[model samples]
Target chain A: MALLSIADALKSAIAEEMRRDPLVFCLGEDVDIPGGMGGAFTVTKGLGEEFGYERVLNTPISEIMLAGVCVGSAMMGMRPVADLQYGDFLFCMMDQLVNQAAKMCYMSGGKVHVPMVMRAPCGASNRGAQHAQSLEGFFTHVPGLKVICPSTAYDAKGLMKQAIRDDNPVLVFEHKLLYGGKRKEKDAISTIGEVPEEDYTIEFGKAAVRREGKDITIVANLLMNYKALEAAQILEQEGISCEVIDPRTLVPFDYETVVNSLKKTGRLMIVHEDNYNCGWGAQLGSWIAENQIFLLDAPIVRVATYDTPIPFSPVLENYVIPSKERIVEEARKLMKV
Target chain B: MSKLPEKERMLGMYRQMYLIRKYEERIYYLFLEGIMPGTIHQSTGQEACAVGMLYDLRKDDYMASTHRPAGHDLAKGVTLTSMMCEMFGKEDGCCRGKGGAMHTGDMEVGALVANAIVGGNMPISAGVALAFKMMKKDNVIVCFFGDGATNEGAFHESLNAAAIWKLPVIYVCENNLYSATTSIALTCNKPNPAADRAIAYDIPAEVVDGNDVLKVNEAATRAIARARTGEGPTVIELKTYRHGGHSRNDACQYRPKEEEKAWFDRDPVKNFRSYLLSQKLVAEEELQTIEKSIESDVDQAVEYAQNAPFPQIESALTDVYWEGK
Candidate 1:
């Protein structure tokens, strides 16, 4: 094992996949620009020199055109890892994703399968609301699309490979702060974890139980998984053994793991960076209340961001999004019941 | 203008136009009589624009169509039976009945199912051309759209990209004068937007009389040859008119009587048929036999669609996700 960041893990996955299949290529803004960060997160840096511009394509600032080209290419037997420089810019290509890419297979009645992956760097990082959003929930609701978010380096590499190989269109939501990307112009404190030296794959729809506990189970995704781990550490000292479950894939959700964990803890708390109302957390919370209500001894609490836009100020942003303190407090409250 | 088609080739153009006209007319009556389930955006009078361009295309070549896809789909060799079944929402439709009327197509035959959204297929067609070039194939894609589509951002962006890349694609604009109820004059200031805007992208552009199948066929042949030879994309504005309304319930009250009559006088099928007969290429008796055969074919399609089974309830969720895991 070697110390590797999320960006490096993704870059490695792209390289490995490109080597495996000649059809696999990446298309987006600044993806192949010499000396430019591989997109906004540096995941695609240096890919152009290795693969050349034809394979690692850098396109004009046309999200719709970029996505349309990817979708059209995928239909014609090419595997394209299309990216939106900023997750917020995804709105610009909503028609392409929602109307074209997602519905291509369904519209064609399974005759056509778009084997493409869309990678978007999402999360609040003191940028204004537009640059920051947990938009996976929006795509998760789309029927033909697959949504997956990987917080760790290992999962990022594995899930990305699966996405590239999968026949259907998959959307990989990577948190901006958790990328562990160091840019020439800017840098942030991030944990660059140890990635495996050998090849491995993390399956979709499997929940990784970070810390096992019997008192309460806390479920989260993306950066919230890191927050849950921190909250669990602090809660351990107070004798509150909080179990943390990181659901790698959101669309093909692993309900069995969630139900099994609920049976042990008898209480559940869902945490996410998305707004509280109608967020993916609500879907899980409602599922537990509907399907496994008998296993729950107390109510299912959800620690999510406020139903408001992410602010530019770090203080307000922290207040709006769910913090480690909020997860611990919610877990404690659920345990009391 | 000098690249005129032989008299025999011109007669073949008449057959294609005739086929699209008869197919669409049969579907329209079937839809009106409540035999077909979904709505239709018919291309009754715009047959030349569909048949003229698509007939010269190789089977491996591609075509991207607009919402009014029945004519284009038929011209591209999508069986009338499957098109009929699709209109009836049957399991045996071209798209397994999921695409309905607007999105009817068969990709195996090189047809990107018709896009319902205006200007939506523009960029997609360009990408398809890009793929063909990347694959080192001489195939070209003929992207068909309405007059109103030229005003969309996708049309401009896709055209510019195609021009720069020297992609093998033909932008066929069936300028039928109206976008739904809005006139083209109201949307675009230029009389010939497709040809006029081609100057901006530095791609050769032309305007052809869409009602005259021979004229349209000649223009399309030249354009396709240029693209095949890597001369880059060409924009052709086929000045035609839709004999029917945009959708099922539209009576086309916005069109004046004189304007409608003028277009009706120059029906593409009739004009081409007259040319074929005048040139003695096909006799009236032979033409009548062809019409009778097409009628029988359309009749069988309607019969098959009427007898076919509706998709099971489980089918709704079947193709949503490929893995279904």
Candidate 2:
């Protein structure tokens, strides 16, 4: 086992995939340069040196072209791992991603396959409204595309490898705060984890039990997953045991695991960094309310960010985003219910 | 003027153009009779542009098309029966009725599914070229779009990327003058949009009389050769007119009567027939036989489509994600 950061884990996964299949390649703005950061956060650093410029391509600042090229290359049997500097930039290539890449297989009657992976670094880092936005909720709503958000180095590497091999378009939303690199954010947590050296892949739609308890089931992902764990630890000290579940993927959601957990705990509280209205947690809440209401001891609770653009000020940002205290408070409220 | 192709090649081009014209005419009549379902963006007057550009492409060479894709698909060798079945929304269609008129194509014939969004196929063609180049193959890709697509950001980005990477792609802009109801004069600032923009990317560009099949063929040959030799992408703007509306029920009142009459007078199919007879490239009897064969082929396609079955209702749930065989 090798201890790696999320950035290194993703880099290692991409390099390994490229070595395994000649059809695999990487492309995006500043992806490969002689001395520049390998992409914005060093996820692709030094990839060009090992694979040469052909495999690690650097493109102009054109998100539309980046997405369109990935779709085209994927259609022709090439597994392209395309990236955007920030997750919010995905809006610029909405036509290519939604209209072209997502619908190509269905539109072609299943004759064509877009076996591509798009990596977007998400989460709030005080970069203001445009740059800092956890946009997973937007992509999860799109059909024909699989969405995965990895919080640990182990899951990042495994899920990325799996996404590359899968014969569909997959979007990997990596949290900006979770990317443990030299240029750290102010509130970045230590997401370093031990990843196995051997080739392995984690299947989608499987939620991981971060902490085991019996009082309430708290489901979250990415940055919120860590916050949920922190809240669980705090609740444990107060004699209120809590179970934390990281769904990992939103589209192929692991409802079975969450429901099974709810069966044991008898209560549920979902947390996410996205907006409160129509957030991914809302979907889970509705699903449980419609089908799994018998298992729930109380009404479902969702703890999400305020429905407003991410602000630049640290105080305002903290006020809008979900914190461990908020998770704990929501869990206490659900327990009372 | 450039020299014409051999007699056999010239006749083949004429046959393809004639097939497109007849097939479109039959489809228009079928829609009028309420026999065909869905809508159509017909390529009535641009048969030569499709045939001349796509006639010489090998079966392995790729082509990406826009919404009005029947002419391009027919030229790229998608069967008439399959296209007709797709138009009828039947299970035997090329895309199994999933892709209607706006999304007709056959990957087996190296045609990517037609893109309905304006200028959506430009960057995709560049990526296709990138794949061929990365695989060390000499195959080229031809991307077809309208004059209005030139204004889209995707067009500029794709052209720049293709030029920088030296990808093997040919951008064919069939400037049918109008984008839906808006005129090119109102949308585009330059008279020759492709030519002016392609020069900024250091790629060669040209404008050809789209009604003249020979001229279009000659221009396509040069561009295809350049792409095959790894000379990067070339943009060709074919100045033509659409005989029908942008889609079904469009009367084209936005166009002036004189302009319509002038374009109709230079109708590509009629003028090509006259050229073939005048040059003695094909006799009247032989041309008549080819036309009759094409008409019969269209008739058979219509019959097949009318009798073909609709897809099972459960099929609607499938094909969203590729279940590997």
Candidate 3:
């Protein structure tokens, strides 16, 4: 085992996958230049020399074209690892991802399959509204697409491998704060985690329990997962035990794990960076309320961003997104109920 | 054109055009009778464009089509029965009834199920051709679209990629003059036709008389050959017209009656039939036999679709996620 950050784990996984399969390649704007960092987040830093330009392709600054190339190349049997410098740009290529890549298989009556991976660095990073929005909720609404958000180095490496091997279009949303290295953004806090040396993969639809407790169960994704852990630590000293569950993949959601945890704890709270209305957290909250309402001590609570575009100011953006204090206060209310 | 095809080849082309015309005519009447679910974007006046471009493509090769795909699907070898069943939203349809009239195709016969969104199939066809090129397979992909699709972002992006990478794809634009109600005169300002849109990407292009089967076949043959030789993609614009309206209920009020009559005067099946008879390749009696046989074949497809069952409710839950279980 070795101590690896999320960026290192992602870079190592791409390198290994490229070596293992010649069909696997990388494509994005600024992915490879003579002395440039591989993408805005350094997930592809040293890949150009190892794989060459053909494999580590550096494309023009066109998000729509980048996604179109991935869809076209993937349809032809090449496993293209496509990236958007920021998750906010995914809106530019919505037609390609939501229309083409997602529906190709079903439209062809199972005759065709797209084995492509799209990596987008998501979540608020004080880079203002344009670059800091959490866009996973928008993608989850599209059918025939798989959405995976990895919070740790271990999950990042394994899930990236799985996304590469899977015979469908998979979107891996990596949060900016959890990247865990010297990042391009000035305000990102470091939170490195340990990853194993041996090859391993974490399958989609499996939730990892970060802390075991009994008073209440809190479920979060990406940076929210780390925030939940911090809230659990503070709640422990106040005579309340909070159980934290991180669902790595959102599309093929692990409802059984959350249901079982809810049955034991009798209290639940859902958290995400997207807005409260129509957020993925709303889907989880509704599921728990519908399927396991009797087991809950009170109504399911969801902590999410206010329904507005991400703001430019650091103070306003933090207010829009859920904070550690908000989580603690929400957990206290659930304890009361 | 191409040294006047031998008598037998000319007769074969005539028969295929006849089949498409008869098949689409049958579908139009059936749709009017409320026997088929969903609306249709019929290709009544555009038979030659489909048959001519697809006749030379092998069964292993592929074609991606648009919302108006019945003609292309039939030309690419999808059977009339399955196509009819799909139109009726039956369980045995090409897409198992998940896709209806606007999207009808059978992939086993080298046709990707028709895409309903305008210009959505362009990039996909490029990908299919890219796959064949990467695998070192001599297969080619024919991407069919309307003149309106040329304005879509996908059209430019797919063409640039296909041209730069030398992908084995033939981009065939059936410029029926209108994308629904909007005319090509309003959409494009280029001198010749939609095929010239490809020149911007530095690929070979040509504008053909879409109603003439021989002319369309010659242009597609050249493009397909260029793709097979790994030279890159070609764009062929087939200047044709559709006799029927855009969809099930449309009466085509936007077009003038005289112009519609003029196109009907030059029906592709009739033109090909006259050409064959003039060359002494087929007599009136042989042509009648072919027509009768195609009529009966379409009758059998309607019968099959009428008797086929609807898909069960469970199918809605399947094929969403492939777990490999």
| Top candidate, metric TM-score | 2
TM values, all candidates: 0.96, 0.99, 0.95
Using DockQ as the measure, the top candidate is 2
Clashing pairs in 1: none
When 1 and 2 are scored with lDDT, the better candidate is 2
Q: Candidate 3: DockQ?
A: 0.43
Candidate 3 collision pairs: none
Best candidate (score: lDDT): 2
- What DockQ does each listed candidate score? 0.61, 0.84, 0.43
Displacement of the residue B282 alpha carbon in candidate 2, Å: 1.9
Q: What's the residue-level lDDT of B48 in candidate 1?
A: 86
Per-residue C-alpha lDDT of model 3 across residues B1-325, encoded as one tens digit per residue: 2344587677767767777888888877877787666777888889899988998889988888889888888888898888888878888888888778777777689887787777778877776776676668999999999988888887887888788779899999999888898887887897455567788899889999999998999998899889999999999988899998887778889998898998899988888888878877778998899889988998998898899998897876666654443
Candidate models: Cα lDDT each: 0.86, 0.93, 0.84
lDDT of 1 by residue, B192-230 (tens): 978899889999999999988778888998999999999
> Which parts of model 3 have CA positions greater than 4 angstroms off?
B1-5, B191-193
Model 2's TM-score against the true structure: 0.99
Lowest lDDT sum, 10 consecutive residues, model 1 chain A, at A182-191
Expressed as tens digits, the lDDT of each residue in B148-178 for candidate 2 is 9999999999999999999999999999999
Chain B TM-score in each of the candidates: 0.95, 0.98, 0.95
- Write the residue-wise lDDT of candidate 2 on A5-58 in tens digits: 999999999999999999999999999798998888899999999999999999
TM-score of chain B of 1: 0.95
Docking class for candidate 1: medium
What would the per-residue lDDT of candidate 3 be over residues A101-178, giving only the tens digit for each residue?
887776655656778899999988877889888888888899999999998888999999989999899999989888
